[model samples]
Target chain A: MIVLSSVSKWYPNGARPALIDVSVEIGAGEFVFLVGPSGSGKSTLLRLLLREERATSGQVVVAGRDVARIADRRVPQLRRIVGCVFQDFRLLPNRTVAANVAFALDVVGRPRHVVRSVVPEVLELVGLGEKADRYPDELSGGEQQRVAIARAFVGRPRVLLADEPTGNLDPATSIEIMSLLDAVHRAGTTVIMATHNASLVDAMRRRVLELGDGALIRDEADGRYDQTVPQPLSPSATLPPVVPPPLVMLPPAVPAPRGVPAPTALPARPAGQAPDAERSPWATPTRSGPVG
Target chain B: MGDTDAQWPGRLMRPGPLASLLWTGLRRNLAMTGAVIVTVTICLAMLGAGLLLRAQVHTIDGFLLDQIEVVVDLSDGITPAERSALEAEMRRDPLIAGVRYETKKQVYERFRRDFRGSPDVVAGVGPEDLPAALRLTLADPRASRDIAVTYTGLDGVEAVRDQRALLDPLYRFLDAFTVGAFTLAAVQALASFALIYTMIRISAHARRRETAIMKLVGASNATIRAPFVLESAVAGLAGGLLVAGVLVAAKVFLVDGKFARQTMFPLFGWAAVWESAVVVLAAGVLAAAVMASIALRRHLRV
Candidate 1:
């Protein structure tokens, strides 16, 4: 289970907050869609859910632990419990599909015996059991996404959040991917996906939340993706923290070099001199020895 | 899954956690790792060669310092009895090794022999013009005071000059060069480390997509870094082993070989080259491992 209460996020340079006083809950075996338009904090919320971004204020609890209180060192453990499918799929192009799936186990120091049995099993679950030997580059988009999904579910993580997973897939391929996710949700995995695709979300009829300019604008039990018109409440009410100076750019200046003369002298003071003269060309400067 | 596939990679590679990391990492960066191994081997070979050459030079330097005799010059016309007494006195000094007298004629003969094949003007010098001298070898060069007190006022000598003055400076220069070789080797070793680090970083960055996936999948830090560090260390090992072999071969066929034996000063311990290579290998590999560890910290960030 994942829970957020009064969560707010503000970026260092952002004009407005990414998340503003948002609260939500996701339970086990539930298929939820975090639907929003562009710049609507869907990605930010996802990042916050993964604890990749910390909330400026409020609590984020996932899988029986307050993830907001987790130190950076212990974040990996939190990540292990919550498998994430990135929008870009982030497949390691260097590893074979089987090795990529096995990587999840390898990092936690699972023995080779467990890896050999598990890697193929997960690949089969993702429908790439036969293509385990292929590299990420050798696979198609849907195939690569499947590899990513396979990698995430290989550990049987309690929670899964996929960001824009079906955004790049065709209509037919999108349904196929959704079915796999639905299958995972049925098997007791709490799944949350953020996507702009309306047909897929409407077809699933799951719980949905809508965001606009970082605010939780709507919540519906069986919501369909729709274009929500913006209503600017008070654009100029908040004062700007710092005003920018007008630009009048100029070219950079170049500096000139100073010429220095070279110093020339023989190696050992030409072989004979007083006892307190320079001894060697490289010798340190102290009047204790002579060179001739 | 078959049992052999499960156990074979582990057994064949003889991998602990680190070895398994190394094996998997090498597989990932196979080309760069291969290149690093070759490069490290060559660099280590050069370092070993320089070290072995320097070792031989040190042995010869020691021998040279032991042999050059200090010449004591007293006022002319010493009697035979005084000379015998001086020899006996010097023999009693702890620093004195041996003493020999050179009469005017002996000096003339030695000069004639040394310059025998010189141009015509040098060959006609007479024995009467030569000065009588005493040749003294000391157990320690710094024990120059033995001659300072014993031969300074003795008859038939004018000046007592330390012969080591000429050769000591030469040895000092050689010593500096040997130190320079070590410094140069250290710098090159550092460069090799940087090269390995850069290779790992580039390879890691290029395959960062995979690494991110690996991280999300719950891979351990050691499992990810082991392969790259192993690849870097392999460079050092290759360098060490090659250098060791080169030194041993040079010793057998070059140093203790015919020309070296026939030379004015013979070099001892021809086997030291290969032995030294083992040390070089250890040092280089250790250095490479350190570099990889530091680089991995930055590159393997979750």
Candidate 2:
């Protein structure tokens, strides 16, 4: 669990604060989307959670520890329980896929037997079991991200913070990644993903916490991406309802096998066509309508 | 997780993985590693050689100084009773270690033997021409000047010569050489430290990605730095061993073989060489480890 009370972060010599008096609480096992544009303090918030940076004012607590006050030496211990994933997939290019994953466990001083068992198991869970021996350069972008995901989840961290994980991937591959993350969330890990992908936010309809100009402007359950903008109820409205096509259909809560690669090549869709809700992988039919 | 944390220290105690990591780091930077080892070897070898040379000079200085004596020459017309009285007085003096009276015949024979290589010089000297004298060895060679002045111009004395005065130039030269050797060794030690620091910096830069990933994965600072420090330590160990070998070879081939065979002065023995070698070995390893640790602190923050 995480609690931030009126956290305000100011970078030295910066013209404005990065996060302005923002306070929000994220509970365990809840999949939350942190929606924001560029320079919206999403990455800063994630770094604060990881204790990579301290809050200039106010308390930031993660897993029952005040992150701002934790000693530098104890940062590693805090990191062990909080996993991070990045857009660039910061994998060691020279290392094999399995080695990259095992590194997470190895650094924490896990026994060899545990590393030997846990690495391959996590790789398999990310659907990269067959490419365990390949290097990052030898894998596709999607596969490399899968390896990064495997590494993040290898420790079974209590909270997973993803900073634009799908920023560099194609749309279909991004769907596969989202489905994988959804599976992880179903396994009872708290997932806080920051992204600018409007369609993914709209399609998933999870709890959305939006940031704008370093301020927490929206906190909505099952929210849409552009919910902050008031809807114009007139016939002269310029923008149509932006319903993207369902690119791939994945089995609910199951990791796809290696043999069946996610449908990465999207089929062209007619403009203004509303996607079928039944076909969207992220749609939860039992959830209530979007609440702001 | 708690169980794993309990076992974390025990896992580090296992040498297999840590050793492999150290080996991998060294292998990855083979050129730098070789440079470090070679630098340490040459630096420590020079230091050991300098120490041994200093020891040898000390031994020779002590030997030559022990042989210093004040020679009091007797006048040709001095009486037999006067010579007997002068020898008895010198024998009773505490300043003199020993006194030996030499007759003109014995002095002439010694002169002939000393100048046998130059026969013309020996032919010019005769038994009657050589001065009969009392050679007084001083308890302390440094007291040679005072004792010589005390006996100078005394009755039945022709001249008093302090051998220490004649050997002063040789001692000064030896002392200068010792200082020069030590200074050169100190410079080489600085060079070795700089080389090690540079090597660690380059290796840390080369493996930045690995270290950064380790930090991200919650590796402790010790765990992140162990391999780098250990690589330098291994190089130091190798270099120290090579220095010891070079020292032993220098002692056997240079000191005992060439110098011992060529000179009559007492030289330092194997025990002194081993002592210097051990000191050099320890200093090399400790310096390398310390420099590498410092460089890592600056270059590898994690």
Candidate 3:
């Protein structure tokens, strides 16, 4: 679980604060979409959760520990339980997919047998099992992101924070990457992804936390991309539907193995449930309570 | 997690991704690594040679000191009683190992025999022209100063000279050379350190992305730094070993073989050579490790 209570962050020598009194609570196994325009504090929030930056005047508690209060030596232990995926797909260009996946386990001192077994299993889960011998440059953009996701999930972190994982991918490839994240989420890993992709947020219909001017603007249980100005969900609006595999068919997403979120999808929304114009862009003040 | 933690030390020691990272880094930057090794080896060799030279010079200084003596020339007007008294005073002092008296006739005969090749000069010299002298061997060469001061203004003494006065300039020259060698070695060592620092800094900069990825994946600072540290230490150790080989080769070919006909102390004894080699190796590794660490702390965030 992650909790941010009135977190405000200001960079040194900066004219404006990056995040202003932002507070939110995200439960385990729930995939959260962090949507905002550039400089709107999307990345800053994720960085705070990762303990990359301490909150200026508030508490950031992750996995039951106050991140800012923890000693630096315990950072590795904290990070081990939190996986991060970046927009650039930061895989070692020189290493093969298998080695790249194995690196995550190796640094934490995993044995040869465990690394050997876990690497291929995770690779196969990400659909890169056959391409394990290929280098990062040799793979497609989608495939490289797969390798990254494989690396992040190989350690079986309780929380996965993805910052613009699809920023560099095309529409089709972005869909594929989103599906992979969805698959990882279904396996019970709490995923908090930051992106400018309005359509994916609209399509996923997951929990959406919107930020504007570094403050919490909206939070919805089953949110959509309409909070900001509406945009097309994808390049091809009328593209044919693709049925992703069920969660059982994918690898287990063990949500802490402590039974946090219910291991069941709330079901995908039926098409044409509500027209875009009929839904209010901003939450009604009466219904939109103050953030915790 | 428990299993991994328990086996961390063993896994760390074993060759894995870190070892491969070290190998790849070295191989890709072979020229830089080679430069570091060569520079460090030359520095260490210079330092070793400087130390050996100092040791040899000290041995020669000791030998020369052992042969030193004080010469006291007696006045022509001195009475036989005064001469006997001066000789007795010299013999009574504990600092004097032995004293020998040479009369005027005896001195003249000895000088004629020594200068027989120069017959004209020897023929011009008379028995009165040569003064009688007392040759005094010191029990301790360092006591020459006290003996010279005591006997200089004595009634029978015309002049008192210690042999050390003549050898002082040569000793001073050798001492200066030793200091110069060490200074040059220190400068070369600084150059070697600069090369190592630059090498590590460049490599760390080049690998910044990889290091960032490692950090994101929960790799500790030690984990990220281990490969770089090991790489430098390995290079330093290789350089140190090369220095040892060069010294041994020099000992075998130059000192023992080429200078075999001369009666001199060995340039550096085997025990001293090995001891110096060990010290050099340890210093090289330590210096490299420290340089790598400092560079990493400044350049690499992880």
Tell me what fraction of the real C-alpha contacts between chains A and B each candidate also makes.
Answer: 0.24, 0.34, 0.35
lDDT of 2 by residue, A18-103 (tens): 77666767777788899879888898899899887799888899877999888887788778778888888888876799988987
lDDT of 3 by residue, A251-271 (tens): 233452222121222123343
TM-score of chain A of each: 0.76, 0.78, 0.78
Any runs in candidate 3 off by more than 4 Å, and if so which? A227-292, B1-14, B61-161, B164-166, B259-267
Model 3 agreement with the true structure over B7-121: per-residue lDDT tens digits: 2443242366678888888987789999999888888787777766676666665665567789898998999999989999889999999998888888888889989999999
List DockQ for all candidates. Answer: 0.11, 0.16, 0.18
lDDT of each: 0.68, 0.77, 0.77
Residue-level lDDT of model 1, residues A1-292, one tens digit each, is: 6666767777654556677666666665667888878777888887776777799887788876787888765666667777888656666666789977777766666677877898898888879999999998998888888988988887777788898888778888888888888877876788889998899988887777667666555555566676233222111111132421100010111321111111121112233332232122224434532311
Error at A274, model 1, angstroms:
74
When 1 and 3 are scored with lDDT, the better candidate is 3
Which should have the higher DockQ, number 1 or number 3? 3
Q: What pairs collide in candidate 2?
A: none
